[model samples]
Target: MTDSSKWFESLRVSYEQGELNESDITHNPFEQFNLWLQDAINNDVPEPNAMVLSTVNKQGQPSARNVLLKSADENGFIFFSNKTSDKATDLKHNPHCSLLFSWLPQHRQVIVKGKAEEISMQDSNSYFQTRPYGSRISAWVSDQSKVIKNREELEVKVKEFMDKYPENVPMPSHWGGYLVKPESIEFWQGRPSRLHDRIRFTKKANNWTIERISP
Candidate 1:
């Protein structure tokens, strides 16, 4: 084997940071998530609300990308993106998706499985208004997931939009938010000796069932 291959195999971690127990967590997965999220923030985990959103297209091809979590509550997790983007197109065909929040510094991860649905236009506009002026202007410039000629073309379009909407930029019709209604949420905490703790909460009817699963 090559020296680089040997080096890769030699790298390992013991994961002695923490342990997760069933009795220690709240019955509500959302509450548990909040607690862990706060811990992540307290520990200075970068972009604590960022999550990996996984979606599958109609043809069974899978795609995963990082999206910032805008809000979370009993309703579910909310995020925003271009409505015409590849992820949005995938959601239109198949709403079923998964979200992963990895706090590597804390040796913890949260996995969420759910279905995504578009939020109201009013909500989208509310969030859009809060964004910075440049971001709002750029939103109107690029047609997400579409091919463009070059960087110059993109910069020219941005300039055009900036001049067009000099002061107050309106929210584009093609931009919106999505709510992922979670069906199952699993909290994973790494432990020593390659063993980990996993606590899962599954939704059934109007209540949630909690259980411990093998790591």
Candidate 2:
């Protein structure tokens, strides 16, 4: 198998579903995301808040995973993960990270690069309580990113936690929230013939500069 041949293999679709015009869009990147998110909701795009979070360790090894965007604004996009997880460890060592949201149904994508910060424990508790009981229990049971013997051991832990706390579970101290404060945010809309629309908002010493990018 050759790499170039595999790379050219296609499950391609012509992006005729959505169009982007210079007339419609907000100056702020967050505002644009909010508009797109609302459209996704209206169109019944499944799990529209979900986005790919990319992080790197101190050694510059990058990792990525799909995570739900719990919050977003000028401060940047927010998501939560276990403090003991590899992602958390990586963030501790390197605060810079990026997030990508591909709203394919709308033929759109957004990319953000930023520095991450941990939010208050009080905030974590508030969101934790909103999660389903099973999810809360799973957070307690799983030693996220840690090595376990097998599924049986994990099941045992879940069972033990469930039996001990049938109705309510307190949010773990180590489990909390993190926010990414963006340095730059780009909005991309797919156009025909591989000529895409890309608009970028870059932060400067005191202001944000907007520019159109080559696709």
Best by lDDT: 1
Model 1 whole-model lDDT (C-alpha atoms): 0.95
* Per-residue C-alpha lDDT of model 1 across residues 28-116, encoded as one tens digit per residue: 89999999999999999999999999999999999999999999999999999999999999999999999999999999999999999
Backbone collisions counted per model:
0, 0
1-215, model 2: which lDDT tens digit per residue? 56876566665777777666667768777898899888888988889999998889988889998889999887778898899899899989998889898888889989999898899999899999999999999999989998899999989999999999899999998798999999998989998878888888899995788888999
lDDT of each: 0.95, 0.88
Off by over 4 Å in 2: 1-10
What TM-score fits each model?
A: 0.97, 0.92
Spell out the clash pairs found in candidate 1: none
lDDT of 1 at 203: 94
Top candidate (TM-score): 1
